[model samples]
Target: MTTHYNVQKHNTIYQVKDRILIGTMPPKAQVIEEAPDYLGNILKYFSKPRTLEDSFKFITSNSSLSEIEARNLVEELIENKIISNKKFDSDNRYSRHSLYFDLIDTPINAQEILANKTVGLVGMGGIGTNIAMNLAGAGIGKLIFSDGDTIELSNLTRQFLYHEEHVNNFKVEQAAKQLALINSEIELVPILESISDVEIFDKYFNECDIIILSADSPAEIHEWINSAAMKHGFAYSNAGYIDSFGAIGPMVIPGKTACYECYKNDGDLYKFLDNGQELPSNLNESFQAPSYGPLNSMVAAVQANEVIRYLIGVERKTEGTRLLINSQNYKIYEEVFTKNENCKKCGHFTHHTENLHASFQESSLTDVYVNERENDSFNSILLDSMMDRLIKVLPNTKILDIGCATGEQAIHFAQKGATIIANDISEEMLEVVNNKVNTLELKGIKTLHGDIVNLNIEDKFNYVICNNVLDYIEDIGTRLSKFKGLLTENGTLIVTIPHPIKDGGVWKKEYYNGRWNYEDFSLQNYFAEGKITKSRENKDGETVISSIESYHRTTETYFQTFVQAGFKVVGLFEPQPPNIVAETHPILFEKCSHIPYFQTFVLKKE
Candidate 1:
């Protein structure tokens, strides 16, 4: 099989006295006579269509270059936009608007810089849509966009990307479709869902060089974004209008300039920012004010310009500077933000004790439960059976679920009129749980965003549930002791884990040496060579696949650990599969009936 690739002819070339030059309009000449001979021939092979394998073969055979050198040269040309005809960039589309950027510092290829950079545009509102256009025209390599909005009939005034036909269509999809028509060369990924959570932020923004926040979100979300930018070390800019006042502000570079909180001196905004904690979850809807299209364009264009400047490594004047514009009179002014020593986001701050724990890479526990594990009847059956037993025994009792991410048990008990307290290290999970509580209109439910192992609370609870959380903890006894202390006299603790014999530790498929060696797998812990480690795919909704580290423990250890924590196993239960499992997955139901996947226990303080 043969592959044909062509270099973009839009770039100029010059060959003079054993020297070769290639670039936009005017080629950048390199004296290759005294340099490596392959440097000159790099352009020759790229001049016509050739397979990647043959191109390497010709280069190494014709010149004194190794296989790596030839490959690197080809990659460099593509990165520099010299090889536009490569199968990768099939559009073969030449950038027509290169003069403006080319004149700035006379870069060899400004398009290459934009081609290599990725920008995440949040919100497909008037500002977000306009910025997407500017970035797409500027030849940004990729634009990752999100907007939790549908095109409204009124949006035509500012959101020029859509027409009446697009009304009620998802703003992101509509904008992406329009932008692609403008520049088919640019890679566009429409984030169908709005990014409102920290884990979601990491999933999207980890690859972006800069984040443009124009989402019609709350001030607290902006503050939360500031914290995330500081934590992730990515630059983010705030640009858009509130009513008629537009501000292109204080683009933040973590560890470099003053963050959003530094300049946003409004006391109401800083009340929660001062402590690095989020404002009340209910405040998400109270911050936005609609503005005209002109104001959104003004702010978005300015933000887009700064985003490009940041990506190209050019000195940005807008960092820590907010340019305010009043569209009524078209008057513009600048305000600067400086580093605040007490700025909670990028300043000296200490974490609360309960907040101190192994920083686990949080995935959507609830999403995972609902998507993959929920269909398994044992999961729901186990929870329902436990709740039913307790509902009869402990009416109006308070319950705690430690390491609860998007609490299933908490919501269940809360709906049953029990006061349920939930805690987890992932703040985003708690945010979702909070939203659930609000939407469900359930009462007596509270969530703590911190480590469950070091939970900070005083009220004695009638029951505590720890499900699948103990497997992650190496030092479980201490946390167990704390949970026991939180219970009233004779209070019960419900625990659930995978049955050991039923679901043995994921044993290595093919092992060597001895039978006792079955506990470890292939990827042994470096520090402890004999012991194995495990990871599971706990994340999705991103181009990059992310996984979470997990600990493997035997079911016997769970029982022994509880008994050692001064608790007696009063009752043990292995649930029968619901009828739905047999109906949907009969084979699985049969296997489960033989050795159920889950083991539940009711423990009482001795």
Candidate 2:
């Protein structure tokens, strides 16, 4: 079979007498044209797909080159990734982006990674709108943005997504509409509201693969985003501009880098997390550093560059370093900042940092649950204990078990005469559940594979259960709202998150990433939220260790999301280990009773 080839759109070809310059950017070029006139002629037509036979025939008719000579030249270009069946040429939408596909040393799969991702933009202003459009132009598939303000004539200096006609239209809505027009292939969702609290702010964070923070939001709100990102283990970028000077973060990755709190707290800076109940305003405004269009554009473009590099499998160069751009002389400079050891957001927090290399989506990468979900004794300890608590509040009607790995709870519930939907992100786990459903000939149970945020279905459920998933979810508030909407009038939502108040707080050592020693221990739990460490031994008697990230919103933020979503919590259960384990491990029970391994919320839609 013959393969068609096309030149990457971004490649700018320069043909001289003895040298060939081919690159998207003029500064970088590679030699493709030597003295061979046939080679240059055949390669120049790569903007559209063509076959070797077609190239050979064209070369023979125009340049007096032999068919064999043309064949060898085309093969050489294919080997150099200059042309192939990679198909960046098909879509006229990506005609400009074709240069990026050609210039970046990363593979063609990077295109898929960027196109399939969804991002959240917290402010749809100058920087935010620019960043959003840049990403959509680069083939980002989905974006959700928020801005309460309407377009004003004053905004025209920087916010180019609007004009004199869009004055009364909401910024978010206009940005979304404009971006959609540019790339109809992209999904643009807009929120015409302000982010007043953690609950409202978190909803956007929940749905995005990575959240971007830009202009208009206060410092205090940005602090919460940093905390939420670390608590949920998602990466976020902070970008903004003022006057001819502008800056883009130090994109924060929870366990891998120091968060915003770390940067401010370095020189005994007052920690925002330590403030009392009310949100504090940043009165430290020294000057109103004025900004213009050119500055905002430069900062946003760099931030988007960092975001794209991160989406693909490229090593992140901007971590713990902010890129400062000066429009005065149009110079770019890097300011390196080291990760703080006593960082409030992630310093005392401990989790497996290896997953930072992957996308922020919760992936079921390890197959540890493959055979385990099939066992009859699967998670029996928590299953039995939580079942007793669940039966009290959860109605026996239609139920949805989200993050239900291998139908452990869903299968059990279905057997007890309750209809259930077993949803999980892992297809392998679902396959196991399906096999068990077939073998036992089970009824009243079905399987759906998807991420909880985007899984669309009719809204008629009596009960919704989300278990052990909050640590990986950036926005709990938005998810709760969706669950509330899905429920019947009196439907119940059963949410279980890792508890900071679980029993047996004793620290122990294991093979890798075990409990922290005294120095790190004293520095932990300073905030209302942080990581909780645990250990287990594998079949080979080798100890394996991991950490669970838990946000202490109940004790910290007063569970404001429930009220905002019009939910009333009827029951709250903190269950300890069964009596038998407590009797066997008396010391463990005594010390850890201060914390429960898990906490449950039984919320009824009002």
Candidate 3:
């Protein structure tokens, strides 16, 4: 059988000065200087599918070239992708897509590849709706999109998928109807619900090939989606507007590129936009930027183009880079981002200096931690025990509360007429503490931010309180010495840490004599003493809520380190859950009573 070849539909042959330029697109074009007259004539034969033998016969009859020379010239054209033996289905809706993809260097079954990919879209307004439309037109196999908002008259300015009749209808439902009309071959799963937690992504988008976030609500949605992308290992991108500019990407392929959190943490462009400036409270909730139709559509088109490129196995231009387009000048600026090795969301470091701060800064986890400390009987008992020693010298005493998460202990001390310096590594936690301080008008407490190891403080204090912080530090002896230096002679040091036994053990439940006991625990690496990483589970015991890293040290190591740092151990206690826990949280109380989870110590500088 004879093989047939045809010139690409988009390809063009033109003359520049005396040279003939034959190419499809800008960079893909090539020049043939002093070209033969038969070259143009031969390409005309390839305008439509024709056998190489027929083209060779034409070349031999028209010119003096032999069949072999004609064959070599045709092979060169095929190799350069100037012509191809592959026939595109002209009747297909995506036929143009196949022609455009032919210009790309990678071999792609454009329509088939896009028809197999699932895209998860979050948001159904402005940029999101446009993205959905673009993807639908490009023949994406399935779209799982979510939005709780109803269409409004204001949305009509930029959200093109809806009409006046769609006003007050749920955005997702209306979007699904409109998208189906655009392409009935694609599948649409419209969810009429607002996404607040990261866990929702696991439930809805786990099977998606890529997830795009265009929603700008709930403030922390970017962080949540980034976390989800990292966890599920899916490609992710975000497109939205920033005031007058349209922002698209930093397209993330988990482990292969910088994630959304990486941009927030270290990207220079992100920092410039953030800049620690607080917007007005009223504006924060109701501020609406002017959403022009052209700007939104332009941003959405570029974003969708990149997504389609990724699905079709072509290089995505936005990978690890964000494109910011100026609405006024129409200038597009690319901001490249690199993955942060210590980023809390996607970092691999187990002993990262900022790991603890990053863990505590997560809004959801911080909320849970704050609530647990405030209401849990076990934490209440621990706080009471620490306060017992401070009550004796509270009035007019100078104290430093290191690693003060939310300033709970510092606020308590300040209320008792003690001058307190509350210090923490997490900026978010400090913000919460500052809010409380301003609300209460507490003048005795001052908030200090930074890692304690590098924190510069000239004043010595009567007491230095380090609670639940030592477990995350690698060298307790050195940190203890620093604590000693921050204290006056004979000053007290109060420390609380996760008990070595509990921190190093793996707990399991065993049925004994037809009754289940949850206290069967064994130490996995109690004697080894190094960094330990654990997954914290939610109440359901199924979902992994978060991962935390801590250093495990033996009780003997802790005591020896204290002695070596010129401190005398005045007291040591294994704190037990308060009796009220037996009634309030019977299960927790029972398990905690049998095994100690926390250890507290009071040391005096010698």
Candidate 4:
């Protein structure tokens, strides 16, 4: 009697006898029994990659063999040297070779099997090399690996495939060699450079089926990856480790899920950045603990696991999501985030405007001092510097402050001669602002309870101020795009996010918060138009990690989204911490100025 195994839509089905097996077949791995050496031939099959144990698992699953018979068959394959016996364990449990191949057990038709697949890797370290080996071993006909550096002896800590003999070899090249040796049937290509270069990015992006970002280049590189992945509609995976913890997942299905950019700029980055600590440099070098090797392998293994599932027709139920790992204590945490409608990379911003401009609303005397002295100092400095800049340029302007938390900025601008409209999704926040307005007898300031995405005011404003709010927003691009709609023909939008690039305390701030608090997002009094909270941890203490409506944008990505949404560049300025306290480089952008920090951009809708 044959038993039917439940399988995904496109998986292949195999009926050996009393048992059933389902999975995708490598492109050229047809079931031809007459050729002889079934086990050996199976090991050699590769249009993609496959391991010896994978074959055993498939054969046993599909055969009518009971446990005893399956064990005997496995033993036979091992004795015949068709498959090797090795113990693979991570976080304590021994992992069988078959465990690594489970992601591909799905039925797929010939047409689906033949489709070309392209993959990208940002880092070429242990996790990266391992992932490559797994895919190449599986028969992914063509392969590409990118890394600017050559192999070094220090890499031996966990980068298993490279050795002292391979020192000075390009990492990608060495990785290619090891992969070729593992399975000569697979083709491999190595890109010996960084992904930071735009030219390099464009070259490899168009041809990729899925981009696996395992490299730890920088926060900015992630934006480029997100931009390419979203613009091309290809799947992208962000996989890496910080300390003992790591994460691996995709960014293909948009809107329905959070893209990588969101993960980087949203609370996660903030938490990671603020964690106030860095992994010991030597841990990844050749000097640290045995844990490095196994840990890196586990990360790579998980990444390959996800990739095989995607390729062999496993519906990635967790696509566009995050899988967080804590190797320190051995805990795996999964966080599901939503794609921001205002995402700077793929959000709704390219539909309007062309010119870029910059301006700020005026505030009244009392409005500037609403927060008690302690809280007001930091905000006051930012406001004073910003307003001073605007006053020198567009003196008499209309301004809107999104997430006007307590309407402090609005009050400040009102005193400075600009008509200010402050908006916040929180009624309590608005009430506080109104109460302060009453206390200060501040006029020329209008308070509105609204969301940045749906601020339906009739008239356009000359300037928009989004301070510290961008990081918490769901879609930075969508919010920026809406800012475009709120702008006059030459209006400007000024947004300030946590200084993700700043050093010292800035970096320390991320770690202080753990993950970030998202519990309050459901409370209407906190944010009226809040999105759902999937997972949130107390992030680094620098910023409040709210699971409400927030998104972060890299300096470049933010500018690009602005330009795409019909805004022209002007001047960019980064804020410097008072000369005394060390601060991350500030980037400022005016409509057209291009400096790195104080990233102040001036824009006008054309």
Question: Best TM-score goes to which candidate?
Answer: 3
Query: In candidate 3, which residue pairs get closer than 3 Å at backbone N, Cα or C atoms, i.e. clash?
Result: none
The local distance difference test score of model 2 is 0.67
- Candidate 2 weakest lDDT stretch, 10 residues: 512-521
Show where candidate 4 strays beyond 4 Å.
1-105, 108-115, 250-256, 269-291, 348-606
Tens-place lDDT per residue, model 3, 1-606, is 777889877778776565778873567877888988777777777888988888778878888788898788888888877788888788989888777777665566678888999999999889999999999998999999999999999999999999999899999999999999999999999988999899889999988999889987787788788888888888989898877888888798987877765666443232344553433245365666678898899889989999988887888878887777878877665666767677777775322112101232333656655656555535565566656655455456899999888777788889888899999988888898999999999999999999888988998999899988999887777788789899988688989888888888876853222123465778787898888886553221222345688898899999988998998898888877778877666556666788897888899987
Model 3, residue 25: distance off in Å is: 4.2
Q: Distance (Å) between predicted and true CA of 253, model 4? A: 3.6
Given candidate 2, what's the lDDT at residue 269?
24
In model 1, the runs with Cα more than 4 Å from the true position are 1-96, 266-288, 348-606
Could you tell me how far off, in angstroms, the CA of residue 329 lies in candidate 4 after the best superposition?
3.5
Give RMSD (Å) of candidate 4 vs. truth: 24.3
Ranking by lDDT: 3, 1, 2, 4
Ranking by TM-score: 3, 2, 1, 4
Error of 2 at 558 (Å): 80
Model 2: what TM-score?
0.49
Candidate 1 lDDT over residue span 271-375, tens digit each: 446555544565566754677877778888878888888887877767776666668876555555667777777885322111111134454455665444434
What local distance difference test score does each model get?
Answer: 0.69, 0.67, 0.79, 0.58
Query: Over the stretch 1-606, how does candidate 2's per-residue lDDT look in tens digits?
Result: 778778755566777886777774434467754656655666677767787677778767777656786677667787876776765535566655655655766765677788888788888888998898899888887887887888888889988888889998889878877998878888888888777777765666675667888854554677778767866667888888644668787688777776776554321122344642343565767746586888888888888988888877577667766555667865555544456565555776432221112112322323445533333121444445675457643345788889887677887778877788998888877888899899879888999899867888885788898877765565677888788888889778887765544312434322111211111112234344434444432222223324434444443332566667788888776666666644544333433343455667788877
Kindly list the per-residue Cα lDDT of model 4 for residues 348-434, writing each as its tens digit: 532211111111334332333343322324344344466467543346678888878766567777887888889988786788889
